[model samples]
Target: MNLKTVVVGAGGISNAWFPPLIQEGIEIAAVVDLNIETARAQIKKYELKAVASIDLEATLEQHRPDFVIDLTIPEAHREVTITALQAGYPVLGEKPMATNMDDAREMVRISTDTGKMYAVSQSRRWDKNHDILRRTIESGVIGKVTAINCDFYIGAHFGGFRDEMSSPLLLDMAIHHFDMARFFTGADPIAVYAKEYNPVGSWYKGDAAASCIFEMTDDIVFTYVGSWCSEGCHTSWNGNWRVIGEKGTLIYEYDKAPYGEVVESDTTDFHRPLKKADITDSPLEAFGMHGAICEMIDFLKTGKTPQTECKDNIKSLAMVFSAIESAKRRQRILVEL
Candidate 1:
């Protein structure tokens, strides 16, 4: 079926979403934004046969699309998604799920009550390398994973709301890494101890750096250290990963394919002999945003649940909020809900 959608929010992020929707041959019925001109401009830029509207309720009343693509800003996510879900349309939204846990929980509750699919576009999880890393770890080649460490350092100079918001790195960026941690470990957070700060000479006005230690399910330890203001020797946006298991370890760095080593033989020597373990790329229908869109499309066509469905995605969002709370109280916070 050629699904139709009403896209809510036509800001800069919408550009990243439009191409994938077009590629999939999904019809965009309309684009809704507070700035009608912005929505109109996006429609024209993409040469979409879609209407531009300023009001979501009015647009929803007029067009019964298959779903709503919510590209609104973080603060607007809860309102836009709840409105669409309540109006009886499934919604695919940009990440950071909501500004706070209360809103995130409420959105999840409404999605369940309405029986509508509300999925977050956690674009990073769809990457092929990420998929392979997840598969390799799960394949038991590295034995049972005990600890996971990630380091992200990039000198981002985005001169927008990010430059001014408090906990910009944790709230605006680290959610991707946090979600990926869950994807790889298949573990939900149990508790978190974190410290957030603004590094010297940082361009962003808020706390642009953070170090968090998360206690995950199965007694797994996941540590994340990141800086949005580091000037040199930057790591990949996916971050550098080192996943340690009982019998071996896997390392992924610089956006390259991951490789690992496992115990080859049991010996009386100080260290057991090790052998190289190759990580092959797992097949993906698409990558990044396009990949996420494919999952939503498949979910609509079939009854299969997408990985980032609100109920599951909320746990990742909880990690972000819990980290912030831990940073604030200078105490470990339990991950609830």
Candidate 2:
């Protein structure tokens, strides 16, 4: 199948999307950005068999691509996605789906009305370790999962739009962990209570750290603790995780191998017999962003549904927004997914 795609944003992330497209032998029909020069630079840098344009609609109208890659910022996602869906094109876009739930629902509505696929790239779900953990829990090696906790700490110093946003950690970064928590637990969000704070010596204008507790479907509790401005012993971008089940626990670190241990059932309530269980990683065909694009490509060709389809991704976005709402209201917010 010959696939021609229009990528709507020519920022740094577009660079990441290109290699996979090239490897998959997909054609870039055009690159579009508000700044034509930025798009031109991408075309030049990649030696793309493509053109650069400042207008997404114009390029889409001209090329009539098989699909659209909406790499634009969060605020632009709804418009870009709607325009493409209206144009009868499927979309593989970056995450946070849209700036807010209303816009997200609108995009999903358009896709539903148009019968087109709109997938959000929840890239973290493509990790080998995460995939392994998900499978292990599903296989009931540790028995039915009851709770999950993730700890993330990073001293990110990106001096751009991120440093200027309010609730920077929750808005910009926490969505990945939130989405991953849902994937790991295989549950949709039910409710959330959260608190945000800006630690002293933090460079960000808004809160750079947060603690969120989400009650998920099936009585699962997912807790996330993250900081974007803490120094020393930073966790992996994927964070450190502990998944507790009825019989045992699964532990995963971003850089190291994930493992599980089982405890023998005994009469003692506090103390139990320990057992070391063999745990194996379920490797990925591709890693990170590339893996996500691969799935999108497969969806376009074979009509397989991507895991982060907009209808489903709204649940993940709901988790992010509910956490923000909880932080602001100082109360548990029911997720409206």
Candidate 3:
């Protein structure tokens, strides 16, 4: 089915969006941006048979797209999404849902009021390795999960808006890992105590490093440490994850395949006996943004809800906000979902 979509925001991210939609046979009705020339440039770059517009309302009214793809920046997400949902279009939006919890809650309320679907494109969820890790843990190969740990270190030099933001790592990047934690464990965050700091040699205006401890449902403890301005020994963008359960442990290393090991315990000895692990590799049918776009298109056609629907995704956003809040307050904060 060719779903006609109006995409708002003609930024760098907008470039990654179109190929996936086109692959799914979705038609781009028009591209809208505050700068019409920017929208026109994207049209020319992609060779799209679509028009460019500075006015979203006028474009939507004229073309009447089946859905809206909100590619706007974090602050503008609420307005762009609310406008489209109220205008009778479902929205597939970029991550963080909104700049803050108040805006995110309002977006969810509008989706319910309008009865239109609003799904956040949590593109990381589409990674094949992450999917493999989730499946392995959920399979109980290591028994009931008790704790999870993730470490991410990168020395990025993104000299744009990110450099100007406060708590850049927590706000701009941690949501993916936080959401992945939720997805991997099927648990919601209860509380978090976090600390954000700027390393001595860091270049960002705000904290680019953070350590957070989260209490999730089912008594799971998730620990995360990350740095966006570390100069060396960078971890995978997906991070190095260790999921510990009652029986065994599952480890996902950076730039390596994921694997698990189950040990057999005997009452005879104090320590449990280790057994040969039956290792398996989980592969992806599609990865990253492409997979999420495919899922969004399927939801539009078949009414199959995307995993990161606005209501569910708000919890993930809550984790981000709570972490930042905890850091600012220098105390533990309950994740107010």
Best by TM-score: 1
Cα-based lDDT at residue 241, candidate 1: 98
Local distance difference test, per candidate?
A: 0.93, 0.89, 0.89
Ranking by TM-score: 1, 2, 3
| Predicted candidate 2 versus true structure: per-residue lDDT over 1-337, tens digit per residue | 7889999998988878889888888899899999999999999999898999987888988999989999998878999999999989999999879878899999999999999999999888988888888888877888888899999999999887788888788877898999998888788899999998899999999899999999999888999999999998999998999999888998998657778788866656777886865575686888777887888888877889999999999999998889888999999999996
Instruction: Score residue 60 of candidate 1 by CA lDDT.
Output: 92
Give lDDT: candidate 1, residue 71. Answer: 95
* 1 versus 2: better TM-score goes to: 1
Tell me each candidate's TM-score. Answer: 0.98, 0.96, 0.96
Output the TM-score of candidate 1: 0.98
Model 2, runs deviating above 4 Å? 265-270
Per model, state how many residue pairs clash: 0, 0, 0
**How well is each residue in 214-291 modelled by candidate 1, as lDDT tens digits?**
999988999999999999899989899999998899999999889899999889999899999767569876888898
What would you estimate as the lDDT of candidate 3? 0.89
For candidate 1, the per-residue lDDT at 322 reads 93
